[model samples]
Each structure stands twice: as structure tokens, then as C-alpha cells.
Target: MCRLFAITSELPCSPMTAITALDVMKEGHDGSGVGLFMTDLAGPWEEFKGAPILSGIFTNKGLKQLDHYMMELGFTTKYKLSIKLPKAPPPGVPKRDVYLIRAYDYPESWEGLSQEEVNHRLMMIRLQLRQMGLDTGDMVVFSFWPDVIMIKEIGDPMTVAEYLGLDRKELRARVIMAQGRQNTNYAINLYACHPFFIQGIATMTNGENTAFVPIREFLESRGFPGYIGYQSDSEVFTHILHYMYYKLGFGIEMYKHLITPLQDRDLECHPNGSFLRHIKHTCRRLTIDGPNCVIGVLPDKTMFMVQDRKKLRPGVVGGKPGMWAFSSEICGLDAAIPDRDKSKDFQPMYLDTAVVGSDRKEVKIWRQTEPLPLQL
Candidate 1:
């Protein structure tokens, strides 16, 4: 099993806080890999919320290719956070020529484009860069989205954080999601790491995805380019979210319905029972049947956690007014924010979806049996 840790706050906090939490739950996961996805960025990145930022590792040659390609596309570099590694990295951490988090200004021609159009272009550019790097193993692009940054590497969580110099004040954010991977289902691959992202949605999961094949087939058949990669079976969870919420124009709550729909008898008493039944039949291919616990952040910065129908994995949400954490273990939560009221801590069951909005005011548990609000 892998350990998942996520935190959201009204004020910017250091990524080290999340990393430390992951360290506390170290026994739950093997030290094979670690991944971090952050948004509502603060520090130096706060001023460039509209600029597209690219996060990834690159070889010396690949860096040149990226520079040339961006210039050809009329994109200009606005700012860059280039990591300076020690001469000798931690024992298990791999050595790389460049680890970059760069923000870029859009092409002059895109000045008046809609946000949706710009988002499409950014995804396309990221895909192209990924393919280019894959051909020669020069670059490994993770994400190219506004106000988001993703860092992934093969090493223990704490060691990777220190090696990457993640303690810097400039690397703060209002929301952060991390995973310490155990590599139970596949070989160790950076792309297979958790905290997968597409467009603006991001998610990480703990537990096996026994129903991976069918879900992958259903998503790949959607004729969407972004749904192509399946380095990890768990990645389908993130794409499934983007499909339901973005492509189908459904509310975020609909995501819980799509992945873990109610049984026939239970649906009979639901207010939207008829519509939900139709959804279950037409979208049956999307339902997941494995033991999994998911933690994610929506485009609006709302953080949420949900469990598989069996509730086989452990999860807890706890914190105070300005901050909240959704962790795979209670110990991890204690490490992230210990001063919060432990009495109010919540452990979501099979039918529960624990959510904390961007305001970070309170934790609301939305249950499967409850009718969703009209306005979402």
C-alpha cells in the first residue's frame, strides 16, 4: 500500500509540512518513490498566477531542445526556479542534470483567447514535449498548467525533499498533495507516481485498482488525447474525474457517483434515482471495483477525500480553521497539524465524501445517501 498526504490552507505553508507528514507514515509505504502536487502557489510564484508553469526533470541536451521549441512557439520565459543539487545526492536519490519549475508568458497571438482555449493549448504543448523527451529519454514533463507545480522522483520522501531543496520559502503554496509510493502494481516509473494532473484537476490514490483494464479502455475510447497515458493504473482516477466534471459538465459530486455508484435497491429511494440508474447503465464501464482511497483537489482549490465501496483503506481528515489535512493515517494528520481539535477529526466511511472548500473554513461530509444540493 502507498501512503497519501494532502493539506489545504487559507495561508501559504511550506511543502516540508506535508513531507514530514509522509515521513511519519513511512511504515505504510516502501521508500521507492515520492510525488508532490501543489497549487494556489505563494512566494515568488504568487505574482505569476496567469502564466503557465512547467515542472519536470531534463537532461542538458533536453533543456536546449525545450528552449528552442518554446521560442519557436512564441512563448517567452518569465521566471524559473532551477534547483541546485549537492555534489553527492542522498544515497537512493538519482542524479539529474536539471530539475526545473519554469513559468512562461503566453504567445502574443493568444492574448485575447478564452481561458478554455489557453488550457487546451497548454495541454497540447505538454504532450508534445513529453513525446519529444520519451523518444530519446531526455526530458520527463509532468505538468504545464497555470498555478500548479508537480515534482516526482525515486527515493524516500524525506530524503527526496531535502535533496530537492524543498525547504526554501519560495516553494510555499496554499494547497499541497503528496504520495509515498510502495510500487505494488507496477515497476518503478516516475510517470507512474501519484498526484496525477490533467488540465486543473489533480488526485492521488492508495490501494489496488483491480478494475483498471476496463476503465482504461472506456477512457481511451473517448477520443481525448489527454487520456492516453496509463503509466500507473491509478492514473485513470484522475482522468475519470476530468471526464465527468469537465467534459460532461457535471458537478464535482458526480465524480463520486461515477466511480462508486449506489446499488439498485439503494438507488430506488434516491431523489435522482431514475437519472442515477440511467447513468449507472450507460457509464457502467467507469465504475471502479477495487479497494482504493482517493484524495484530490479541484480547479477551485477545494480538497476532497473518498473511499471505495468496501472502505478497505484507511483515511482521516483533521485540522483547525485556517488549515485541514486529509491523510491515509491518523498519525500522519497529527504530524501535519497537531494543534487542531482532535475531537472534530473525521474518518470518512464507504458512503462519505469529506470535503474542505478553498476558504478552509470547515469540513463538510457529503454522503452517498444524501441528495446533492441543486447549486453544487
Candidate 2:
């Protein structure tokens, strides 16, 4: 039922803008299957082009509130914005849950469905559901972010259990609830972020902007499930804006009035559902494990970087700076390198800092470097 009762009140202040994902691709991004980075986010930013948007990715339980929030703010998307989301997991634990879904498709098949088609499908789902009185997106938060549950452990079993005072035969008979005293506090962070698949072609190669579904093809061996799939808020917003202008005949002032509620809701609840910082810090807390240099903050999440610096078989490493970037620290992307003197044994000059740039869509290699200010 949560999926069937969400609604939004967003009123578009503009016409339905037409566009092609390829049009926003950065130069050299001509389908060079690589990565899109923070810079690549520029591409999406450019495409959005000053359109105020109310975007969010969270799990169930908060869908109803969040949906209302987005609508009041003058935006739209494919979310069951009226229903309460579900708990995705318990606290202090990581669960990479899955979802299944079926989005739209283009005429061509790039391996399977193109990103644009996926985005379109997501957009379409929200609108279709709006008519049906349900929302697939807002309720989707449950797929990822589960509700948090608190648990407690009992200790000193003998003190709390009658079995301790019983005879051997009696004690053996059902040990009636030993260890009933509270010994520890436990809480589960069961929560999931809403899954919004903004389907677009594999455009940016600078390697960034990978939301949920882009990297994982799970939960959809058959069809992407609503709880596990995604929808593009951008497309959803376009539809909403178009509806407000032409369908409902809302003016700029009316739209602005609508947006105020969104802003207020965001101010109260934005940034409630992201785990990026936690993931990043977990990785930063990693150490080198033998031949493998693994860094990760999570007890379970570990990643391997370049092998030992002493190794000299293939590509660049820390000490061997033929063309590699190095900071004084390991994995330092902006490692300061001295002038192009072949006599220096490729050893970078002892400087406090450096910079690097790259044009490669796959591997971003910094082409140049500048020193950071030396503090006395």
C-alpha cells in the first residue's frame, strides 16, 4: 500500500524542455567507456542549467514526508512521495541490498538498455504511478535504507535466571530464560536511501556520478524491482514543471510559493540519507597488507591500490616516478616531481607539494603540477 498512496504537489514554472543526453557530453566524452568525476558532474550541472531542483535519494518510511517536501518545493520526480519508507538494515552494519526493476528502452541496445532509456523509464514510472495513486520512488527508500532497530543484551544469567537456583534435573528442564539482565546496548542502522536511476547513456568517461543502478546490475536478472530499481528525478521534474505551466496554468509567483515549502523541508531534513563520508573515511583508514596496499575504514570494505613501491615490472609506482604522480605520502595523486632531468633517477625533488591534470577519460593522469605554498 505504501507504493500506492504517495502524491506530489509540484507545479512546473516552465515548459517541457527537450534534450538529448549526447548533447551534454563533454568533449572527448564521445562514448569513451571510462569514468566521470566531480568535474564530470559539471556536465549534469550544465544540463540542469539553473533549474532549481529538489532532489533526494533515501529509503522508505520517509517517502511520504519527502514526497510532500519535494512537491511543496516546486519540483517533481519518481518517488512514492506519500508513503512511509521501510527499514533497510540495522545500525553499524553494512548491507548492500538489491532491487529489481523494468525501465524504458531506446531503439538501440548498448549491451542492454541505454542509460537514457533507463532514466526515461524511471520518469515514466512516477507519472504512471501518480495516476494509480502510488509512488515507486518515495517508497524505494525502503529498499536501501531500512529502519534502525535498537537491541539490548542480557548478562549475569545466574543472577537473573531461576535455573541457577534449581537442582541439576530441574536446571536441565528448560533453563527458563537465564541471563535476563541488561548487559549491553545494541542498535541497528536499518535504513535505505531512495534509489533513483537517472538513466542516461554512458556519457561521461571522467568516471564520476555513478548513482545506485549504474554500477550494479543486480536485482534485475528478470526485471528491476521498484524497491531495488531507480528513476531519474531530472526527467520527473521536467514533467512536473511542464504540467504546472500548461496543465494547471501556474505562474512564476505561484511556483515560487510552492518552492518555499520544499526549501523549508530540505533545511530540516536534507543530507539525512548519505553514507559517502562514512565510506570515504573507512577507506582512508586502510593500511598496506603485504604486496597489496589496501586502505579502507570499514572493517569489511577493503580496496587494493598500486603494489609495492619496490616492485618494478610494469606501470608507475611511488618511488619510481618515470611518469607517475607522487606526494610524500602513498597514493598521493599530486606528488611533486622535479624538472625533467633524466639524471635524477626519476626521484621526485624533495618539495612540499604538487598538482597534476589528465585528459584520459578512463584513467585521469595529471599532465602538469604546481607546488603548494611552503609554510615556514
Off by over 4 Å in 2: 1-39, 42-46, 49-57, 77-354, 358-376
Instruction: Give the TM-scores of the predictions, in the order they appear.
Output: 0.98, 0.20
* List of clashing residue pairs for candidate 1: none
Which portions of model 1 miss their true places by more than 4 Å?
Answer: none
Candidate 2: residue 161 lDDT (0-100): 18
Give a tens-digit lDDT track for model 1, residues 15-109: 99999999999999998999999999999998999899999999999999999999999999999998998988888888899998999998999
Please write out the lDDT profile of model 2 over residues 1-376, one tens digit for every residue: 0000000001110000000111122121221111000111121223332222222233444445554644553344422212122344233222222221111112233237664454444445443433223344333221111011011111121211111121222111100000011111142111111111122111000111122232133223324333222232111222222333344454222221221112233323424212223322332221111211111000011100122222221112122222322211221221222332323222222111111112211212211022112221
- TM-score, structure 1 vs. true: 0.98
Report the C-alpha displacement of residue 308, candidate 1, in angstroms.
0.6
TM-score of 2: 0.20
